[model samples]
Target chain A: MKRIRTAVQIIFTIFTNGYAYGFLRGKIYQGNLKYACVPGLNCYSCPGAVGSCPLGALQALLNRRGFQVPFAMLGFFFLFGSLFGRFICGWLCPFGLVQDLLHKIPLSRKRKRLPFHHILKYGKYVVLICLVGAGSLFLFGGFAKVPAFCKYLCPSGTLFGALPLLASNEALRDQAGGLFSWKLGILIVLLILSVKVYRPFCQYLCPLGAIYGWFNRFSLVQVHWEKERCISCGACQRACPVDLAPEEISRSAECIRCGKCAAACPEGCLHFSKKPGPNPDTKPDLKPEKRT
Target chain B: MNVMNQWNQKGGSRQHGSRGWLFGLLVGAAFLCIGGIRGELAVIWQKAVMICMECIGIG
Candidate 1:
């Protein structure tokens, strides 16, 4: 499943950003299909990118008056989030693909699990609320300039959108300044961290991930834990790359729905379900039976 | 940890029945219709095609 997912990610990445020769000429695709959202964190400025990024669109629109709502972009997000949730992160995002590939690099430590990882999961939400949501709307919107998140943070933008342009355009390289260096530093740090920590950007900084994760409870495709079938074997927990125990598999907001846990389950107790289930609650015992 | 262990040990109904699917479809349709009316496609096109100097922090 993981191998297939990775293949799909690569294919989607190429299909969306396939103007490979454009990089040499330093030209971004200026076609009509560019209006469509690719449902992932692909950069619009990528030479081969045929679709716009939802985050970038949202930010871009913020700086323009009478475009406050960003209805089309929000609609795309609403549809995709409702259908797949963070499955896009696991299965389609180019940057997510990059992180997974980076983490696969042979290292002294096979996997480095961060302590208080659950607490860190909220970081992405904070970014969504403050940087992407507020900063773009309030600060940059008033200034009628570039969005704050894209300018200051967004390693994916730096890596896919900027780095390629810089490599190809000599004038762009000569014009590189302090902000470029700062973004490069961020990109370097994220790239190195991706090797040690599984999807550090998705877990800690991606506003897109945070937005999609909220819909996980309602997404049509979801992980359903069959308590009756589970034998309490530790295989699923052991197999989880992000270190989520079997019980935590369905509910963990940070779960990318990568299917590692489902694959590891010996009894096939874990599976995807289209039926509506109680969104997994972090506090299982205290969760009120809201349905009943 | 103990609560998680206990919760995992217990058996219960796995999935629920909700109107989320219906609601989701309605919301998606509404957004798409409004987006079409608003000329959001043109906005998306302009943004996507333009070289965002700010995206690279060049500004």
Candidate 2:
């Protein structure tokens, strides 16, 4: 099933990316399924998407079209975030899988993020403000365009989401201007570096990751461990793809709850419980690990 | 004794959890807001939300 899902992931990503890049990135796909909601970070602009992407929907809502709150998208994210946290970052995201593959190269010189990068992570907020603030202004301004995020920054949309589609569509290619070129160049750099740098986009610039990460600590889905049961061997922390210290914040919103930590626990000390479950997401072992 | 201790522990846990959550939330939210403001992370959030939804679904 995992292998099949992985294959499905690739197929959906490649297909959607082809269509998004070639045919419908800047333009919305008129197809019903394309406008329908899909689960992962597939672009709404991609021709294969049936529903709109929540981020795109959020940006659209940030613009305050007809006074809608993007309830579907917002609720969707909340329900998902509250349940799985960063689990999405692990098993599902096409981009994430891409980064994992990149990390497979053994010869790359690895570098831990700089101390100042903690500050740099804040840059995603600026990106959000500019996109949402400016995008909303389209209501009154003459320069209204597709939300800036899609146009400027998203590598998934550019490389895996948009470029393939654009390559097949002459109209899109002919229409390719400075903006498209600029977005493409950005994607090229990020894609090339993601393997070496360990999801630089997610670590540094992903506004969505930032948002979901905020809710990770309190989200209903959480990881709890019996610290007393823990041998302090550090296996869970070492298994984390993001290099986060899982033992420190097993329930951390920054944690995708990928279960890698639990899977890696040599002592079988780490266990997960649902929020409605007993005092989970903690390092204490009182009675037992009650499965939520 | 057990009830009193549980209450105290709960209080302490809430306090600590709130602090950790607040710190993470503030930092993460700040990054998101800043990224949104800069217009660089427009699409990442949408895709992320969708991915989060699917994650919870299958998870």
**Candidate 1 segments whose C-alpha is farther than 4 A from its true place:** A141-143, A276-292, B1-18
Task: Assess the local accuracy of residue A53 in candidate 2 as a C-alpha lDDT between 0 and 100.
Answer: 60
Query: What is the alpha-carbon lDDT for the whole of candidate 2?
Result: 0.55
Per-candidate clash tally: 2, 46
How would you encode candidate 1's per-residue C-alpha lDDT over A84-131 as one tens digit per residue?
888899999999999999999987475545667768778888888887
Pairs that collide, model 1: A17-A48, A276-B16
| lDDT of every predicted structure (CA atoms) | 0.77, 0.55
- DockQ values, each candidate: 0.38, 0.05
Question: lDDT tens string, model 2, A1-292?
Answer: 3355456557756654443432443344454343334445556544444455656666655544344334444555555665556666655666777766676677678643534776876776676667544644453434433455655576666654455556555565565567666777777787678657767777777777766775565555567666666666677778765666644455444565566677788777666664321233344433444444
Task: Label model 2 with its docking quality class.
Answer: incorrect
